[model samples]
Target chain A: MDKPKKSALIQKDGVSISEITNKNSIENLKNKRKSEMDPNELVDSILNKDITALSRAITLIESKNPKHLKAANTILKGCLPHANKSVRIGITGIPGVGKSSFIETFGNHLTKLGKRVAVLAIDPSSSVSRGSILGDKTRMEDLVKNDNAYIRPSASGDSLGGVARKTRETITLCEAAGFNIIIIETVGVGQSETTVHSMVDFFLLLKLAGAGDELQGIKRGIIEMADLIAINKADGDNLKAAKLAKTEFTRALHLYPKKSSNWNPKVTVCSATENTGIDKIWSMVLDYVEITTKNAYFIKKRNEQNKYWLLQTIETQLKFYFFNQPKIKKELKNQLQLIENNKTTPFAAADYLLNL
Target chain B: MDKPKKSALIQKDGVSISEITNKNSIENLKNKRKSEMDPNELVDSILNKDITALSRAITLIESKNPKHLKAANTILKGCLPHANKSVRIGITGIPGVGKSSFIETFGNHLTKLGKRVAVLAIDPSSSVSRGSILGDKTRMEDLVKNDNAYIRPSASGDSLGGVARKTRETITLCEAAGFNIIIIETVGVGQSETTVHSMVDFFLLLKLAGAGDELQGIKRGIIEMADLIAINKADGDNLKAAKLAKTEFTRALHLYPKKSSNWNPKVTVCSATENTGIDKIWSMVLDYVEITTKNAYFIKKRNEQNKYWLLQTIETQLKFYFFNQPKIKKELKNQLQLIENNKTTPFAAADYLLNL
Candidate 1:
């Protein structure tokens, strides 16, 4: 049969409709395949600063499937050489302390300085709450739209250790993707702050100004972990309270022992809404890097952190293997009962289980 | 022939000299055997409140020999039923904070109140320092001489976990031996305070008045763990400073979040030298017990602590087994080198080692 003549309304273009659709589908298929790229190709794409490749690599790292884990490890090994080049800053605060706003403002500031920034969250509670702190990109609208910024919500896992490992591996992928500054965000309510603190070069604690009670709601060990405490919402009516809180924190920080970094913890007032004090915070980070790097503590601390993560990962996996064993699952309940009955001490029970 | 050579001055009233000498030697041998009693015999003696048997049992628990470990486990199982009966109080202070004197005074006070007091130390540094904090019985001369008090020096061990286990086991033996009060002493420095804090019903931090610097030299988490902070050496000229410190600490303690036990940590000035305020400290402990028990937090906390120790022991053992393997020992070194050379991520290295 002869082909139907083209209607006057359907003006002929240089390319035929069939050719155009075929070419479009082929390109779409190529992109789909690239999303599921081999480990080496993913690494190559990540190294060439491909954010999609980095995200896919992180998905592989976060996968529960054993096959995906194997691929993730291969990609991780490829990325390791390029990792450790970025400065990882841990940011934490209570739920309403403007974490997202602070991150948005700070991340934009970082990008403006000709830097690539990656923001990762570690809210292990997200699994239970089903509402991750960073799950909504609308919270950081401007930074989300920035080409130099990448944001990943908290990865849900059965335990903080599992989530920590996924986030840690994602950091390596982001670093390989040429992100020079990585911000690890966590809520201050749980042990997530500690996990983030262990992985970061500098830890920033965001605080809200309370009525003359600066340290009232601060969690223990958090201030000690913080390299900087930024009292947010220091605009309009809250500015005075934030300044007072900064003074109180400064006085409180002096009570802590001299940090091994030989750098004093600094307290500052910031207004994420007004986008004020963000530059000073970045300058402080630069100052910290300059001092720590000059004294060799930066490299030393990174090395120690690497060793910490190595041992921590091993210990976590060891526990996972032990507690998940079917024999242990059954015997542990029996042992706990024995403990409750006062028939066996925890030490003795531990011995019995270890023997088993 | 020697019996025949006895002069009139050596004449026996009702027995021969040879018989008396034989009787004395037999008694000495029996006492020696008691010191080296078997596990069952040790358990019997400990139940009867025999101090020597308790000492021997603790020695076995501290020994590095596998045979001793077996004996210790047997003794631990025997004593397990009787453990958790005593009020275990953990005392910690810096080197010059008068921990020894304070413990001596507090122990004597406890004994005077008709409470059988057992003192155990957990100074892991003693292994290297060759100077355990409680090594010299002369430090607590009055308490050592008191029939109602027992003092044992810290058990030297290669690791804090080893020392902690030994001390924990010793506490069981002490409780089994009918001691109603157990005091665990550790230096304020390092992780020993945390170890001691974990294994006690109450944690007391001893401090000195440091020229208006109330919190100076205080470790980060120590204050948070403390159920009470005693300003020691509050006599003569130091009395005013001690009171000042008490006020500052009271204010500082207010900054911490409410403890899980729902008890406010108290601060007081005490003179270990003058023996004043000792009774008040004991009264405070009783008050703590009354409140926590009323709320059932006392038993609840102990149960949680038991679970903590159980999991901690298992984790420590797991790491020990994994790290001590000849294959792991060698591969770990290789993996560390790979980490240093940026050839592997910590998670990947952990996976490799875990698979092996």
Candidate 2:
């Protein structure tokens, strides 16, 4: 039970174990310093399609440190010009709807078509659950190993606004890193889908066929935001149900007013496990791109989205500043209590807090 | 074309024309002063159910002047304890869905039941169009003439938030005036429906039977918000279509997850013009109330709504304070331009403006 002597763990080259360990620590420090490139160098590396540098820039963007934020902004400024070239697609579905599998199949298809694909996620719940949708790359075994594909898990943050901001900036970094196709994935349970919808050019909603209850459990307004609905798990006996779902969804989609892009949202049946209908989904996305581009809605929508983000950022920051103030924070709780007790109206409570 | 002699024009009573004009002016001034009572007097009159005082209090709440705001807050604080006693219902339909007729018939029915009804509208477009949904009360001729019913035009403001706040405060004033049934009406074409939805105890969506397109042109998420969907104009040849719509909507409603109230949303056909089925609609509302009250979701929802309003008001004010700043006003345009040119990301632009 006695501890082994340090020399007993020495290397075959006859160097002492402690000396080798010290050498390894210095080497690790050197590697860390090398990876912490200056903003200009990081931008240059990203422009050269260096995935390491791209990931580093995103880390900086998501960092809470003021210093990292300054560097992230500098890198963003450098990357901005090259950012909007990619076709950003958003994929969303409720849990167990095969989002990861569909993304894997769709992303691999894109890479096979000579497109560099980058996948990112926005999971606001990850900050609470400490587990993200794409946190395990093994979920997409093939795409994770594809040289032309890069996958990044959802950014952890206290708010969807914060996570969305990081993911949006990460899109720019990925696009600047020569990823021609960016896929933003989110679980279809909350405000994250809307956030993703606002940032992407095309939105795909994945669904699973139920027992004649295809629309149940779907988030409200999500179908309206969809550019396409793909019914997944359409293999074997599920094919009949999937086709039924497609028909139902197609009829339902017609109920919505025509989208601004003038593209009718399509509902199709797909099976990610069998890889059937994956190619058709790609073709539909391209069709959308072509129609929107021909009608000039592609650029118009992007410009509108940019403006939306600008306003949204300002508003979120304004609320954050107001709510985070020590006095306002304390008074807000008191005012809410007063509101609950009917001692004050919400309007009066608001006025008092604003004055304070 | 000769002008009449001034004394001849004015004096059936043997008074000088100038003296009569001055007397009339003084009388009008005295009446105006009488109507513009102090906050305490206004509160007392509102509590006494003086309609004129309630109207004046609402006008004060809708005023933009700081002095009037102070007075309005005082009146609201006085009225807070007496509020929350009414069944606040929100009614929404597209422009041609017979909202006025429906409200008119419904309000008349409520009055027949000895319930004091107060009708208010939230039309954000009124500020721009200079025409409000309820500004012309003639649409509801009978309700306007009903002694127990009070109808107020949509409050005009530059923003929906501002108009909504005014309407919310007016609800307190109305409840204080002993109105037991408060109906907030909004056009379903915009965000006004969502605003109205937040403040109401029950939401009612009015729809028209279409030619096999029951859900077309309906606002997204409107169906999910409804406690009851009343298909109006269900008379003459439209009765069959209305029934069909009710069936379709009932099936569609089933697709939505059950609501927190545990009461299923009902769909029915009603004829506002004939006043048929109005009683059934009211009964459905009462059923909803009974169920929600028993389950305690009625009080819980109201408390959540109050908190929602308080937070909404604070956030709206925060944005107002930020966007109204001279520096931000000038720089926001610059930032938007930069965003358009792809020279800056929204996050970076936001950070720059926030630091300022």
Candidate 3:
């Protein structure tokens, strides 16, 4: 395919040229085998801001094979030195809250400011749904077509912890590829919002106006985790109601004790469909970064999060190690049944399992 | 000391006759020695509503010696058949929120209604302070004098897990002793609130009226966890402000999505000092129990909490086992330092530790 025609055809489907290259590279990877591969070669490409290499590294990280995981870890170690440069933000909202349009407008706004934006997502529901949610490029059409932006959906068919670790490493790869603004998006369903929130500097909760006191299906825990809440669709007939919702949320936010970071959560009104108040949200994020950095909370929070993930990773692995053993699994099931019957205390059962 | 004077003298300190009897029994136990005593004899005494034996069993559970642990476990297994009969309530507030006075008043109210009451506390701070907080019976004078009431402070000098397990076991012992209503008190300073909340049927958050915007230092997370929030010290000069605080909290609670229990959290005003609204708070708790039992959430939530605690106990043990190993601890310390230096990703450090 000719370059312009290929670009036009791919744009019709909202798939980026980089995504297409990633697909071709996967095919090339199998045929090329192990002969011509150098891990550092890919690392150098990624550090040199090569989008194709970054996407390929992410694909490897998402792979379930042990060999791929080894390669992924090696590349991740290489990329670590180049990471933490981007302002990572997490965006989440219930369905029908205009998350896709908001992300597109926000990405475009960032690109217009001469910042490269990379969008990623964490949807562990792909296995149950048999398809990824954000994986559909047709949703974020404008940003997909923007040469200055790159978007990838959730890595499917793995445990939630597996995907979270993969996404965390993918952030490093994107940062190495020179994406100055990285957006991690999650649907406000299940625990994905928490996963995304832990990995981001700023967490934005998008809400719709006039849910009529039901919180529009947003989980209370998610709202509590938000650093900022934007009432979306604040234009045309919805403008007044959105403004009212903003005030209501502001009052609700006041009930919370001040955060340890000393950053009070802000509520604002926005209409992503009309591209209104998009810059204001970005500025809010910038303000958060500046203030937190000044107070040293930015670095402190990141280090703490790093330590948390370290302990979390170890716990997950240890659980996997014990759980995967046939003898332990059989014993665990019996002990669990006893616990269900109230025949054994949990501590006693744990002691039994440890002995086993 | 004769029985009546000993009881009256201990009552002045708010210590129950049962506590005094338990102290005497400990001396008798030393003279009798282990070989002459049967664990089932104590279990039978507990089952027969012998408060002294119940307190002694709890002391055994809280002991660190393996021999005592074995005896405690034996008594717990015997008592398990008679447990789960009581309504467990958790009450928390920052210091000076009058938790002790509220519980005393509430306990007296329950006992007046001819219900057996047990008050326990999970003060993890006792060790740090080198003195127990709620362990001071002088604070709960009225309930300590009530023949139908039993109170115990947190078991000091153990890990939080050890304390939680002991408290949970103590609940069984209390229920076996025919105490039908259990109140667990925790200072809202740390994670003890969550631990207490998890084991209780209802969680009540106590706040003060005139703390201005501080919410009496109760955490937003704790408020969110509450089934009921009571503004204490709502008497005389604080009455109007307490009512206003009640309105503010009701509005704040409205912003959160309805809890899965289908029960909306309530905010009420009460004065522990004046002993007003004590009956109302007990009525609210009873109402919660009635509704949840009718809807079957009462049983369902208990089952879920049981399963949750089981998993939590296992995880805590696994972490302890791995972290306690001398070689792993040394290696983990080095890897953590590297993570702090940003020279290693958490996942990478986790992998190294797992390999070790």
DockQ of each: 0.40, 0.44, 0.35
- What TM-score is obtained for chain B in each of the predicted models? 0.88, 0.88, 0.88
Off by over 4 Å in 2: A1-41, A65-67, A207-216, A231-280, A287-296, A340-343, B1-39, B65-67, B95-97, B208-216, B231-258, B261-277, B287-296
Report the C-alpha lDDT of model 2 over B151-244, residue by residue, as the tens digit.
Answer: 9999999888888888998999999999999999988876888899999999999988974333435554788899999999999999999999
Flag regions of model 3 displaced more than 4 Å.
A1-39, A127-133, A207-270, A274-276, A287-296, A336-343, B1-41, B65-67, B92-102, B124-133, B157-159, B187-190, B202-303, B337-344
Best by DockQ: 2
Query: Per-residue lDDT tens digits of candidate 2, residues A218-240?
Result: 66478889999999999999999
Task: List A-chain TM-scores for all predictions.
Answer: 0.88, 0.88, 0.88
Q: Model 1: per-residue lDDT, tens digit, B121-148? A: 9896876775688988788878887889
Error of 1 at A257 (Å): 5.6
Task: Enumerate residue pairs that collide in model 1.
Answer: none
* Candidate 1, residue B253: lDDT: 86
Q: Which residue pairs clash within candidate 3?
A: none
In the predicted model 2, the residue pairs found to clash are none
Judged by TM-score relative to the true structure, which candidate is superior, 1 or 3?
1
Clashes of 2: 0
- What is the model-wide C-alpha lDDT for candidate 2? 0.87
